[model samples]
Target: MEYSKDDLIEAKRQIDSTLHKLKETVKTLESKENVSRLKSQITLAKRRIKAFEIANYFLENEIKKDK
Candidate 1:
């Protein structure tokens, strides 16, 4: 499925928000297990954000080429 620019942007925003929340949770957590879980989640979210950024970059380049 293809995502429009706006859709990608929204996805990126949501991912960023989630990442921020996860970081905050990490800071407040006392249990090693819980902190590890949150850290793993944060890592996954960061990877997703990178994926979105790469996708957006390619999409923008494609648009520029089409112009």
Candidate 2:
């Protein structure tokens, strides 16, 4: 499906917001004294952040093309 520039822009904004939150979560999780149990959570968050980063990169390229 084709999305308008505005829609793509909004989606990019949401992704950026999510990316920020995920990074913060990883930071918070890593700072814990005992992170044995949180290891999985931190790993999952890191993976998610990576995925979102890829999405953000595509969105940025698309936005630039839309210009």
Candidate 3:
């Protein structure tokens, strides 16, 4: 699907926001007394954060090219 420049920008903004929250979650999870209990959730969040980061990078490049 072809996304308009504005749509891409909006997606990038949302991804950035989610990335921030995911990082905070990872930090909080790691600081918990029972880190092992939340290992899977932490790992999942980290993976999702990585995926979003890649998407954000692509969106940024697309936006730059659209300029």
Candidate 4:
């Protein structure tokens, strides 16, 4: 359950990237039919990144508790 500081940093970066992609996807959604699949992909990426962030938080807490 323990993660290094680097792991936490990476997780945060990934979450940020996913959020950015989601924003771009939303902007595209209003403009193009061809982008629906890309939008769906970004939506799933957002969900996954969210889950990763939540899990990373809990795991980090657990690591701190163990210390």
Off by over 4 Å in 3: none
On a 0 to 1 TM-score scale, where does candidate 4 land against the true structure? Answer: 0.49
Per-residue error at 13 for model 2, in Å?
0.6
**Candidate 4 lowest-lDDT run of ten:** 58-67
Tens-digit per-residue lDDT, 1-67, candidate 2: 8899999999999999999999999999999989998999999999999999999899899989989
What is the clash count of model 3? Answer: 0
Which tens-of-lDDT digit does each residue in 1-67 have in candidate 4? 5667667667666766765675666566646777756776757756765776677576566556646
Ranking by lDDT: 3, 2, 4, 1
- Tell me, by lDDT, which candidate is best: 3
Angstrom error of the Cα, residue 30, model 1: value is 14
Which window of 10 residues has the lowest lDDT sum in candidate 1? Answer: 22-31
**Model 1, which residues run further than 4 Å from truth?**
1-35
Evaluated at residue 44, the lDDT of candidate 3 is: 100
What lDDT tens digits, residue by residue, belong to model 1 across residues 1-67?
7666676567656655765665565455534555665676666655765665676566556555545
Q: What TM-score does each of the candidates earn? A: 0.48, 0.94, 0.96, 0.49
- Tens digits of lDDT, candidate 3, 1-67: 8889999999999999999999999999999998999999999999999999999999999999999
Relative to the true structure, candidate 1 reaches a TM of 0.48
Q: What is the lDDT of residue 33 in candidate 3?
A: 94
